[model samples]
Target: MPQRLIASVLLGHYLSAFTTLGIPLYLPRILADLAPDAPGWSIGVLFILPTLCTALAAPLWGHLADRHGCRLSLLRAHAGLCAGFLLAGFSPNLTVFVLALMIQGTFGGAMAASNAYLATQLKDGNLSRALNWTQYSARLAMISGPILLGLLTASGMGLELYRVLAWLPLLAFVLILPLPADAPRRQARTSDGDGDEWPDQLPNDLPRLLAVQFLFSFAMVVTFPYFVPYGEALGVGNDALIGLLYSLPHLVYLVALPWAQRQAANLLLPGLGLLALTNALQFWSDQPDLLFTLRLLSGAGMLLGFVGLHRCLSQRSRNGSAGRLFGWYDSSGKWAGAAAGVTAGLVSQSCGIASPFLVAGLVAFAALVLARPLLIAPREITA
Candidate 1:
């Protein structure tokens, strides 16, 4: 792959993740400004609507990329993000802001399109490395984007911060424009001579892989929303310290990316096992230091499992189907995260915050058992 293409893809991935992940950091402020008396239920709706819309739109965008071209698909997503941010930043009412976010989701398939574009540019071995790099970039953004936005808001930017940040995706759109155009891969015709379309049936292994993706997502998110509260309960009430605890895993994940990529094939079981152990152990400790250590290990475990799964998926996908396949994979993880969030909220409310970790651990363990064959079996492209 050309260095320029790699740079463009990584930058685009970073910007997309930065904008999306940073929203949560400023969500309360945004909500307060838009609807001072907004109901608690509206909070969930605002967050979930874009996610659900993205999940629904991803595969369609992938198919469009497969039929049209990756560059155009990516440009469209970026354009939409730019418009969405502008609309969100300037909206006089909550309804308009939310509708803009929904519009963003409708065109928000940048990550999927980037993956597909990279798939076309790199062969299998290099593809794994590229995917890991892209993931690392996104993770880095997720860690830093919120901090950056928060700092700006603290310095008196307030909601104006959104208008400032809106320029990023627009810049990304310009950056991608100079890259070489990506042509859609020609598809083989059906027996009855039907026109080109996405494959009617996915590989048998795909469902199992998606299941693992869901479990990994569920396990991680089950404990995500409660981290601040969990830390406060342990007597670490400082916001900075709590934020550090939450970010420790991602920091470790960035550090562990290269090793995870190198050991991708053999990582699934061990990684899942480590995640299970860490999550389960969370139930036994409220000490800040121990929890930090557990989170660090959990981060390492998650990096291994996640990179391993993507490597496997990339290797297994047929040439023309990469976009659609990754789209499904991305959608599966998003939906799983959404489900975990809701379920964890309920479980935490009823049984205490610690209970979600226990449940997440069990789910990870079950996924490990169920995914054993697929993980250990020889890699082959399936129809």
Candidate 2:
């Protein structure tokens, strides 16, 4: 596998996360000027809606890629995302801002398509490691975007940061021009054809895996958007400190992800336990330091869980439904994210920030309990 292709895929991931996150972090600032009616929690709700749109759109893109080629679908998705960011950067009205976010999100399945592309291009044993490295790019972008936006805020010229963020997607459009699409390895094959029976190729474990994805993703996305507010509630209200608190998990995740990738299915329970502990800390702690440490542990859990999940699914790619499986995974994950975001935001608004964390932590703990059956079941391998 050429490093350039991996680099290109990572570039897309980086830009997508960078721009998507800038909107949320800067929402507090943007709303301060335009939509004073929008409370911070409302802004959080607004931020998650786009991901809801992405969740809705993932399957369409995935299905299209299954019939067409992932390369073409990816190119079109990127082109649309660039346009979406441009609209978001210039939106003068809250309604328009929401619309732009949806557009950007609708095209968000490009990441799934890109994942399919990489799975097709890389050999099986190397797939999990490659996915981790690709994921690191997005994680890096998530960490960088907020820190830079925080600096821009301190300098008092942060309103223009959206424009800066928009440039990344625009540059991505330009950069994607030269990459070759993954050649179709199963073009003439059909699930109905004896030569390529699709159902026979489908992973029997999909239903259980999808359930696992929903649980883990729901816990993750829901907990994530609330971290900043959680810190503020704990009396660490500084923007930079809030950003640092949010960044802590990714910092820890980067350290754990690569190792988990190498360990594969063997890492599942430890990963689930990490998630359980993260929630446990939230259930008990009120101090900033203690909560931050817990958040880091939660991130470690996510790293382990995701590496295991993706590794497990990537194994199914050779079954001839890789694109469809991944599309379902992305869609399921995003929907869970969307639900978590809205529920967590509303819960925080109605009760308190800490309420959502404690509640969602409990949900995550339950998810870990349910994950055991699937991880232990022996069935099929596909990647």
Candidate 3:
């Protein structure tokens, strides 16, 4: 639990996001230049395609760590990200670019790798706090990565720009390379009986926890597709305001971390319930103030729910399967987000842009019901 190691992990994670999110953020312009004749719908498919690859390939990362150990696994992810970005940077055609994106998705998962590494080194509440900090790192990256990257590339998705950006992940790899090996920290925990427990020694079944991850992730992310449009629908004309609405949930994680962490167990149920309510309330108000308030509340719910669910899964590290467990856990969320995006697109086409919020609300309510037992304070917390 060295502060230096924890800070390094967070910084590495922040850099990794620049490479992982570039495709989704810049695909439209990239496609416009490379494949102008391509159909509009293909853009959406390609946007989600990399995510699907990540979801499918996630469990493999776990197995890698189980065999090679977490430090190597994390370094591998950073190197993979650099390679993927380099490939995309130099891609000569749409085929190559798409392949490069797939490579990035398939190989890059520093966030999950970081989790596995941290889970190996810490336990109980300390682990939870570290995971929460990781979440902050991730949110900041997601919110600012594209804007900064866009400025660097001039939004061009060019060879030189991408190649330059590749250094970020390489930088991450270098940051992690200096950290202590996993065996020592893991051994220390094992001596305390943490390493003696079973990988399945969690509060509930692994599959059940995975289920909550999927549902909760789905509900929380379903708003992504239409938040700007929903804001516009509410008569918010300022581009900045629309952007703020979209970012409020992420900002909440930064602003309310201490309170949210303290009340996470209590917030878990309400947070899921809030996602449901906020989405439903989206239809009830066209007032910008009310919508902004709803978005703020939505952000609070997300923080609570995310921290709680992560703690629930972090307990599985007792048996030293942190890599695999977190890998699969990462997959579950990716799959859910992809599903939510696809579903949102289809539903929005027929039902209206705001329709997805209602569906998300219903999904959130169902997720709340499913995740209730895990949120309750119990003997399983320290396992």
Clashes of each: 0, 4, 0
RMSD in Å for model 2: 3.4
Q: Model 2 over residues 27-102: C-alpha lDDT tens digits? A: 7787676677775667766667777888888877777776666666677677767777677768887888778778
- All candidates' TM-scores? 0.92, 0.86, 0.91
Return the top candidate by TM-score.
Answer: 1
Candidates ranked by lDDT, best first? 3, 1, 2
The segments of candidate 2 whose C-alpha lies over 4 angstroms from its true place after superposition are: 32-42, 153-160, 183-201, 232-242, 286-289, 346-353, 376-383
Model 3 RMSD vs true structure: 2.9
Which parts of model 1 are misplaced by more than 4 Å?
Answer: 187-202, 378-383
Cα lDDT tens digits, model 1, 259-320, are 67776255878889999999999877877778778889989888877777767776665546
User: Which 10-residue window in model 2 sums to the lowest lDDT?
Assistant: 191-200
